[model samples]
Target chain A: MSTPIYNRVALIGLGLIAGSMAWAMKRGGVAGEIVGYARSEETRDTVRKLGFCDRVEDSAAAACEGADLVVLAVPVGAMGGVAQEIAPVLADGCTVTDVGSVKRDVIDHVAPHLPDNVHFVPAHPLAGTEHSGPNAGFAELFDNKWTIIVPVPGADRDAVARLTSFWQALGANTDEMDPEHHDLVLAVTSHTPHLIAYTMVGVADDLGRVTDSEVIKYSAAGFRDFTRIAASDPTMWRDVFLTNKDATLEILGRFTEELFALQRAIRTGDGDHLFDYFTRTRAIRRGIIEAGQDTDAPDFGRAQKK
Target chain B: MSTPIYNRVALIGLGLIAGSMAWAMKRGGVAGEIVGYARSEETRDTVRKLGFCDRVEDSAAAACEGADLVVLAVPVGAMGGVAQEIAPVLADGCTVTDVGSVKRDVIDHVAPHLPDNVHFVPAHPLAGTEHSGPNAGFAELFDNKWTIIVPVPGADRDAVARLTSFWQALGANTDEMDPEHHDLVLAVTSHTPHLIAYTMVGVADDLGRVTDSEVIKYSAAGFRDFTRIAASDPTMWRDVFLTNKDATLEILGRFTEELFALQRAIRTGDGDHLFDYFTRTRAIRRGIIEAGQDTDAPDFGRAQKK
Candidate 1:
């Protein structure tokens, strides 16, 4: 086993990301001691039973004490509160990082609360499943996935490098981007698509003529994929939209404009327009497969699973 | 093997659906002989080499000449011409069916040209993958899926019953619906969702600031799912939008209305509204899982594939 990167590591929230990180850290032997804390007593009990972490702490501040690495894995809206609660107890020269989906707002809320001696690095891992909470995590969740690190300006270079090594050791490829760009890219790639999916599923649910049973039975056609995406954690998504408001709104605007154009083509019976648009989109799917972001297997390989 | 359901079965288009049906029929020994034809000579040549069919004919009429069952497996737009071409050659008392996505349009296009002596019972198997063409077919494609059979007024009851049994033998559950209701149901569960996915992917492709490479790289963050749906056959989707225009347009209107509300909530920083809507959509996903329409495995069991 490799030597530990951090003498001690603290995970502030015991959700899917934190649980997965703990397991991955254990798998790689990358942390000397992993201490976890969650807001709820039930989650703490569950994590303690899971035994992925070295110890479970009852308080966030207690978890951060003497830890050279502290990860804030809470929802975006709750990051600042947790940061404030643990700020005074953090060890000197420690590194504080986050796994929130939105980076700009996280920086705005978390940077001031961290002590000057500690380095604050914000990151978003572009990997997840529809499932959430402690039981949803696995050691291989981040394998071959992209984790974008958004380092703040005037940050200590050594702290950033060490944190990058930590993520790379957890089986994720690492890249750096400015917080604004990171937020904008995530809005396009994650937030907006999720919102659209939620909206479509809601529309299907609200339609009285097409009963829920029929919609559920026929969802394999295409709607089931949307439903999977729409089933993500509601509290997390609420914070995402509220925190990354401008970028998500911007992408949504572009999406609606394009949708209106396609709708008009359908109304006018312009088959060429529809065909060309669809043909162009196929190239993107090919690019995704070529880039190793997803599998080219039919139906995302779900058909083969049967 | 059990007795054949039909003495001879003719497939007019050698695409994914027909190829799969041929394989399923062979697997179940449901037909004594399977004859196939495609508009393109190259497809017919591929089918002959693949040997899924007993024979590959040069013309649709030639394939259907003495067949007891004829499946119009072409695109929705092409069904009318194929029906017209084979009108004179269809054997008396034979059953004709289709695997089109849109039923009302198929019935409108195909029924008028069919011979009165033959029964035209339109059907749609709600199963497919992003991949297309003859080589993409497998016998398991239709296993446990649903096929809705729509019979015209005064259609032969025996013919409908036989067709239903044929689909059941191919490993599908059978249901009957009026043409109009089937169109509306599919619009909610398939067509509108596909259009939205196509539109989202097109929007991402058109963004100048977000490079195609970046979009492709970060697509695992939910955008990849839309890309999969968008990668479906261009001609098939184009025909679907054109033929199911009324029902599709109606659903699209509802989708846009619901989307605007969510957009406004995001703009106004209404977290409760977003949270509630997201929570409500989750129930539909649960229903889909319980109804056996989709897998409950995380990420559609894609992680396990790796």
Candidate 2:
């Protein structure tokens, strides 16, 4: 009913999040034309075949032409290069944003390459899956999820408000945060947890104490929980660790301190200590479930399997 | 078919695993009569309400009377006490077995108290739920799972074979192991991982950094995976850590060593290290899924939501 927010919207990398955004944009009728580009020729061809974009461009600069909004959806490590490549062609009045998990580095990397006319709004949709690539995107992925925006202070208020409304139309709850706090909170909530999962699964795989057969066959108990997270896109996680180094390292340090105390309790045959720790952790889980982020199912799939 | 394997089977505790065993026994017609007992009056009443047994007795000695297979399914911390309580009343030629997680301690606790005419076979059924108590039990919980038995040397071969058949009828694949090795293997595969999960959740809760609301809202990402695991029964986990102290501490030490190395990588902005670790873990998840223990979906959910 209302005018489309952007005349042309460009996606620099048509991976899972980018492709999903394309679908969401089309379903919402939010953009006049959606343009996409990917690093690989095969990926570009695949996005074209999937029809996730109105036009598939081979270069970031090509995609940026005539775009009033450009979203850099590549791994964070690639954001700087993409911004540099697209800055020259970016249309006047266009807004540049990113879907990177880490915020401070993304802002640092992209803001310098952008023209004064382009408003750089760094955002994280706080939604994903273990699956990657163009074909994995879905329209509802961002529905009811949080999208945090980190806009430079005193920057274009109208652009910020427009992006907020756009994410709302995509079914996301939007909030503004300073880039540092965003990175710190996400470190505790996402990055540290992901790294722990990857480490534990790696330890098991390297030990060879339990054959892969045993780990898999008996995984339903608790190990399977880690595997899902460990299966996330490796490249994205690598960039995240590289960029959010301080906060992630600080959380990991805190986590290890707690773990060491637990190990000491176990070593000393301290039943009450173990009991107290286990009991405390249960309350947190109950709170999480009560808050509706999780199901009350005893194990992840037990109810369904039973 | 042939006379039921046991004329009367006694279950010392009727939690998830024990209740499932009773239902599985009845479903497969493996026992002529199943007698169950619980420590507390409330649990006994709940067991009676659930109709998981042919008869409920208030005391272990009374329940084991004339029982041909007396099963101790109490917490690992209570195995010795329960075994001692029932040894005098257990029928001659009865096969006394346990369904505890740790085998060496179970053997040490239960084997010495048993009469010569009665056989003590320490068994660990690698199946369960985060839920405990009689109401949480279901018939098929053990279906297609594993049950590992650690029989003492010179134990009755016939008794061992009969116990093997019983678990097989309950829909588990049974394997024999040296109790010490079994404890050590499980220490790495199950106990240590559970402790780590609990510790991580506890750390997050204590920091209060993620905020309870944010945790549950964004929990569908990776934190919810830890929540399911951390939700496991406190008493059972407490007993596991106390009883399997040496193996558990050993594995915990190894895990911490690896974890610290990872922390250092994060602190140093080592993207390559993080990427390599994450990539290797993903391969392990693939192996587990191929082995039929896990599904590709996160938390093994039926549908991949978002």
Candidate 3:
């Protein structure tokens, strides 16, 4: 913990990312006073009970009033509406940023509503767990994770620098990327992978060859990984697919093409192709471990619980 | 450590499963003298340096001489040839088993070559890291894991009991399933899932929108999990797909059907369908955790490396 980066920080939509940001900000002394609001009363009650913020607000507009930094941590589909509600109340010179997974969609939806006095910088933090809601927040959720900052053209440099420093203080490594590139990169890295996992898990469920009980019981083989990825927050993912349609479908089309080729190889007993393909992918996993993004311990270093 | 189950145990291939079995058996006191062999001199040297086995033999036959148990831990494609080599030398009444992912193929390929005096019991342990070769083995690999024992009809009861006890001592819970059912179950849980993960990782590598460096750098989201599965032994995986073609293709067909449906829903903006499918998958994950096959830790309990 150190000197505060912002005097007051208000978080709109107290879910996993927002709640986690609150805990991480407090842990790093990045904000003096924190206030949070969620659309659902149940979520609000949960946030209040958890005490993630110094104060809880009932509305988004109330949360943003007089705050130096206001984070729009809502679902992508809801960002425009939330931005509309907060636009009238945003303090002058307040820096507004969002934590949505999709960047261009959020910028398009949110930029029109924000007042000129407030600096709107967009960010997408590549961090989270399958868990969600208020209880899912942790002080270390953003620790050592990547946060990509996508600033609109002609944006204030000082605001961008301050937000970058704020994210760094909250324990994330920051980098700059254009909104279009960010969407394309994330579609390949996160969005499409998640959809594939969800689809595979659903396939296992529908298959009669392996009963659901057996799939669940013997998941440690490989299916368990897909299940964990597939178990992410439902509404949030739905919104991500709905918002990042072009990039996602483009990646999916490529994915299906690659999948059909591999399927053909399997059917044809082409061991050389399969072996070569499998061997190449292993190098990328090694790169992830070498880059310090992941641990090399077998089974992701997860302790085998008895 | 307790009394040895067998005076001499020979492991035919010094790969991940064989090396782990050797270390685990020694750790749990199931084998008195463990002898191992691999065709690759490099692997043999690695195993010798590691001292996983009491003696390192140059050939499968040399390793199997006078052993009470012989484990064929080679890739599924090579099981029959290895079985033929050792069949002429296997001790009378010795139990010859394998650790291949597919059970029916192993039974069909290896059973005829085995001596009539030897008992053939095919087994597939439902555990492994996405690593291979001698150095990948650890004594704790089988702890809290499931090992499915696929005993052919008319298998000697005494040999089956001894093998069960040996695996139990190696820290695994054991169960028996018919060879066909085991193939079907594993095709769903392990083989098909691995293929899908491999296909997805390959797709990411081939995509022009996302650079390989970016894919590896921001892999923590969900792509990392797929990479881990995709990084598994190429030779071993190729054999699994080739030997278990029928079951794998059956389940894969089902997987494609489900994936296409989800992809259609995404194109048409069916948020409700997406949410419901995602929610249903979450329960399967919960069931896996409850069944003790996997831990409920966020990110599969992998500690965030600093």
Candidate 4:
């Protein structure tokens, strides 16, 4: 492993992304020591038992003490509170970053609370699974995944480079993007799609004509993927929708317009319109496979589950 | 391998489902001889080269000659024409079934044309992948999948029993349902979800702010699964929506109402409403996993893709 990037790294939340980050750092030996904190004592105990970090601290402030790097891995709604709590304890020259999906709101909430000496670079790892909590993490979660870093204006260049290398060491390819664009990109990529999935699953449940047992039994027919996505943590998604409101609403507007047009085509027996739309969407899937973001394997490699 | 379920089995369309059926039949020795036909000579040539069938026939009638079981694996739109073409050649005591997603349409279109001597039992195998064509087939595609059989009123019981055994021999569990309910269940479980996925992918493409490259590169954030579902066969999905128009539109309407409510909840900062909706959807996913229709593996077992 490469030399340690930071003397001490503090992770302020013990959830999926944070736990995975700890595991990835330990596997790559990227930090001299890792300290962790969570709002809940139960989560801290679980993390200690799992040995995800070098030390478990009672509070976020305690975890940040003497650490050269502090990562805010809490939900989007809790970022500001955690930032305010840990701001006083951060060491000089420490780099502060976050793994929140909405960057503009996170930067707005986190930037003012951090001291001038501490470098604030907000980052979002473009990777996750349906599972959450401390035990749901593995070292390979970030391998070959893209972690986008949104650096604020006039931020320290050396600190940004150091954080970039830190993420690189954890098996992710890093890119720099501005906060507003990052939020909009994530709105299109993650936020709206998740909401749509959740909405479809809700509709299926609300329909009394189709029994819940029937939906579950025959879920392989396209609905199963939506269910997988809809199964993501409710609290986290609630925060995402609330924090990224404007961007998510804009994307949802476009999505609703497109959906209405397709619905009209189906009603009018316009096969060509439906066929062309589906055909065009196939190219995007091909592009994703070519970019190595996903696999070309059929069924999303479902056979591997067995 | 078990005993042959039929002396001769004919597959009318040499696409993914039909080709996979041929492979499964060969692996299980469910059919003594498999005859395959497609509207296109290219597909027939590919099927012959892949050896998915024991014999490649020039026409649907030729394929059905002397066959005790004929499977119409064509798109829902093309089922009637193929049924009419092969009606004269279907042998006495032969069983004719289909693997269409929309059962009511398939039954309405094909049942009238079949000869009285033959038994017509409409079946739908609630399984598929985004990929299609003859080359996309595999012997294990049907393993542990559910195949629902919809038998018309006064349909021959013996024919239904034999077809159930055929699907079971191919490693699938079987159930019987009425055609109307089957169409409604599939609309909830498959049709509306697919249309939503297609529309979401289309919206992502239409957005100028998020470039296609960015969308493709960052797709794993829930958009990847939407792309996969949107990449399904254009013709097949088009036919499905057109054939199951009433049920799909009904579900789409319900979906829109639910989506609008959630959108309002987000606008009003109603976290409890959003949280409750998400929480309710999670239970359906859990039920899917418990019912053995989907794996609880995070990311749909995507790590195995690498």
> Model 2, stretches more than 4 Å misplaced?
A1-7, A26-30, A302-306, B1-5, B208-210, B302-306
* Lowest summed lDDT window (length 10), candidate 2 chain B: B297-306
lDDT of 1 by residue, B1-306 (tens): 989999999999999999999999999999999999999999999999999999999999899989999999999999999999999989999999999999998999899998789999999999999989999998988888899999999989999999999999998988999999999999999999999999889988988888888999898889999999999999999999999999999999999999999999999999999999999999999998898888898888766666
lDDT of 3 by residue, A154-203 (tens): 89999999999999998899999999999999998899999988888888
C-alpha positional error of residue B63 in candidate 3 after TM-score superposition, expressed in Å: 1.0
Off by over 4 Å in 3: A304-306, B303-305
Model 4: pairs clashing at backbone N, Cα or C within 3 Å = none
Residue A128's lDDT within candidate 1 is 93
Q: By how many angstroms RMSD does model 4 differ from the true structure? A: 0.9
Error of 2 at B41 (Å): 1.6
Question: After superposition, which runs of candidate 1 have C-alpha atoms over 4 Å from their true positions?
Answer: none
lDDT of 4 by residue, A270-291 (tens): 9999999999999999999998
TM-score of every model? 0.99, 0.94, 0.98, 0.99
lDDT of 3 at B123: 91
Docking quality tier of candidate 2? medium
Q: Model 3: which docking level applies?
A: medium
